[model samples]
Target chain A: MHLTSVLVIGATVIALLVLAVYVIAVRTPEGKLDHVGGMRLVLWLGAIFPTVVLTALLLWALPAMRPLPHQSGDLRIQVQGEQFWWRLRYEDGNGPGVISANEVRVPVGRTVVFDVTATDVVHSFWIPGLGGKMDMIPGRINRLVVKADKPGIFRGVCAEFCGLSHALMAFDVIAMEPSAFDAWLASARGVPARADGRGAELFSANGCGACHTVKGTPHTAMIGPDLTRLGERRSLAAGTLPPTLESTAAFIRNASRFKPGARMPAYSAMPIEDATEIARWLRSADGEAGR
Target chain B: MNRDPLKWHERLRVSLWTLIVPPAVWAGHFLFSYLWASISCAKVGSFARFPTLFVAGTVVALAIILVSGWIAWKQQRMTGDPPPHESGTQIDRLRFIAKSTLLLAGLSFVAVLFSALPVAFLSDCR
Candidate 1:
C-alpha cells in the first residue's frame, strides 16, 4: 500500500479513539467536567472499549513493528540517542564496527533490535514507518524492535523535545540489501584515518578534542559523538544536512548557523584563516583509519 | 462553607495519594529491574521482571484513579449546602478536568511501562 494510505488508516484509528472519548465526554453530565454523572456509560464504553481495541492493535502490530525471533537469528544494533543526534554503531563481531551518525543503514527483511539510551536529556527514538517509538531516558536503557521491509530511505526524528535544537534533529534510515549493507559496514570499518595536514595540526591545537572524539587518538573525550567513521555517514550536521564535504566544512566552520543553540561552539571566535583550516582538517581527519 | 477540619483531612488524604503513587511506581520499576537483573545474572530464572513491574505499576496507577473517584463521591456527599448557584455544574466541570488530565497521564505512563515488559522479562532468559 502507498505510505499515505497507511497514514490515513492510522489517522482513522486515532480519530476513532478520539471519537470514542468525545462520545463519552458528551454523554457525561452537563455540570462538572470531572464527574461523568450519566457519563459513566461513556467512560465504560470509551475507556474499556478502546483498551481492548488498542490491546489487539498492539498485539497485531507487534510482529510487524518489532518482530521477535520465532526461532533465532536476528540482527542486533546499538542505537544511542544523544542530545540532538543519533549515534548508530553497527556491530557484527567481524568488522571494526561501522560507526555512523544521524543516518542508519539496515538490511531489508530483517528484524533489528536496537539497544537505545540517551547521553543527556530525555529523547524519544522513533521511526514511524518501522515501528513504535521508544524514549531515550537518561540513566535508563530502552529497546526498540524495527524492521525495514523495503529498500528505501525513511525519515526518522527525535520525537521527544530534547533542547533548543530538538526540532532540527532528524535522521534517515537507509534500507539496503544484506550484501550491500555488509559491504558498506566493512568499508566503513576499513576507512583509513588521515592527518588534517595544516588543518589537522590546527584542529588539535585549537582544542576541538575537548568535545568530540576521534578514536585511536588523543582526542578521547566523550562529550560528543565519536567521529571515527564520519566520512562514510550519509548525512552530517546532526542529520540536518546531507553528508557532503562542503556541508561538513560549513558546519565545522559555524555549527550555530544551521543549528541554533547547538551545544558545539562555533569557530566564530577564531580568525577566518584558522577556521577554514579547522574545517579542512575536519573533512580530512573524519573517516581516517584508526592508528 | 467554612473550612471544616474533616474536609481538610479528606483533602489531605486525596492529595497524598495523588502525590505519592506516580513516584512510588517509578521507584518500584527501578527496584524491580535491578533485582531482576541481579537474580538473572546469578542464573536463577524467574518471570521477566519488567512485565511484573508493569503489572504492579498499572495496578497502583489504577488505584489512584479509583480513589480520586471516591473522593469526588465524598465531596458530593459533604457538599450539603450547594453553592446557591449551579454548584453541581461547577463541581462537575472541575472534576472532569482533573480526572481527564490524571487519566491521560496515567494511561501514557502505563503504555511506556508496557514496552519495558518484554525487555525486563527476557533479560536473563537469553
Candidate 2:
C-alpha cells in the first residue's frame, strides 16, 4: 500500500480511539473519582501514554526519512527556472548534454538527480506525484533526487509565485523505459534535417532565427527556446496552448493575448497566411528530423 | 540526610521561578538543534555523518529535564490537604508549584525528544 494510505488509516484509528475515550469520560457520574484519582489518571493517560506512543512512532519513521541514495555516475539533469518557462539540459555521460525546453523525460526505476537553479527570481520545482518540492534560487543550485517507480506522464508546475504569467508556467514529465529513453536521447542529440518551403522562407524573413535555434540551419542564436524538435513537443508556448496548427499560428502572431507579459514580441502586423505557413513548417516531421 | 519531611522540603527551597526550568531547557534544545542543522548544511553541504555534538547536546538537555522532573515529583508527593487547595499555606503553595512544574517537565521531555527526531532521520540538507 501507499505511504499516504497507511498514514490516513493510522490517523483514523487514533481519532476513533480518542473519541471513545472522550465518550467514556463524559458519561461518567460526577464525583466518581477524587482529585488524587484524577491526577493519577491524567499522569498515566496524558503523559506516559503519549510519550511511549510518540517515541515508538519516531523510531518507526526514522529509516524512511532518508532520501534515495545517489552516486556520481547517476544521470544529472540541470533545470533552470526562468520567468515563465523551464530550461532543461540532460547529461548522461554519453555525449554533450541535450538541451530542451518546457518538458522533462526520465527513465523509469533509475535515479535521476536534478540540479535546479533560477536565473531571474526564486521559483520552486514541484512534481507532486514524484517527490518533494525544491526551491530554485538564483546563483545557488539545489539538488532533488528522484526515482520514478512506473512509466507514465506526469505534470509539473512552478510552485513559487514568479512574476506575471507565473500561473501559465507548467511542463510535462515523461517517464519511459531505460532502452527507450536511451534511444530518444541519442536521436535528440543529432541535428535536425533542414526544412525548405515558403513557410521556411517566411520564418527567416521574420527574423525568428535571431532568437530561436534550429539545428542543421544557420539559426544558431538561442535567446529563445530551441525549436529543433518543436514538432515532437506535446504543447506549445510552455504548455499554454495545444500544439495544433491554428494555436501555434495564433501564439506566434500575438503571444501576449494568451499569456500576459510574455517576452516574445507580438507579430500582429504579420499576415495570418504567413504565420500559418511557418507554424506548418515547424510542426512538420521533417522539420524535427534529427533533434 | 534529615528524615523530617518538613525540614527536607524547606532545604530543597522550591520556588515559583523553578516552574520555567524544564520548558526553558526544551526551548534551548530546540533552538540549538535548528542552528546546528543550518550551520552544518551551509558549511559542509550535509549533516555530519556521526553528529556527536548534537547527540551530546540532546543528552545534556534530557538529563537536566529529568532531574528537574524528579525533584518536582518528590515534592508533589509530600503529604498535604487534598484538592480545592485554596489555602495560602507555604506547604500548599509549594505543592501547587511542584505539580505544575512536574507537568511542564513531562511536556518538555517529550518536546526535546521530538526536536531531536529530525536529526536522527535526515542525513542531508534536502
Best by lDDT: 2
lDDT of 2 by residue, A7-117 (tens): 898799889989998998899999998887997898887878878977877787777668888999999999999878898899999899999889899999999999999
Task: Write candidate 1's Cα lDDT for A1-291 as tens digits.
Answer: 464786689789889978987897689777655444445656666576767766665555444433344223456677787767787777666745566577788888877878788877888888887876888888877767777888998888899998888988888888999899877777676645666477667768878889877765678676676776666565676678866656666777688788887878877666666665655555564443221
Predicted model with the maximum TM-score: 2
DockQ of each model against the real complex?
A: 0.07, 0.62
What residue pairs clash in candidate 2, if any at all? none
Off by over 4 Å in 1: A1-67, A70-73, A95-98, A193-196, A215-218, A244-246, A284-291, B1-126
Q: List per-prediction Cα lDDT, in the order shown.
A: 0.65, 0.86
lDDT of 1 by residue, B9-116 (tens): 245433444544544555665565566566754565544544665566556655654565455455444443333323456554444444444555455455545544
Candidate 1 chain A: 10-residue stretch with minimal lDDT: A63-72
In model 1, what is the error at residue A23, expressed in angstroms?
A: 22
TM-score of chain B of 2: 0.88
Top DockQ prediction, candidate number? 2
Candidate 2 regions exceeding 4 Å error are A40-53, A286-291, B1-16, B44-46, B86-92
Worst 10 residues of 2 chain A by lDDT: A282-291
Cand. 1 TM to true fold:
0.55
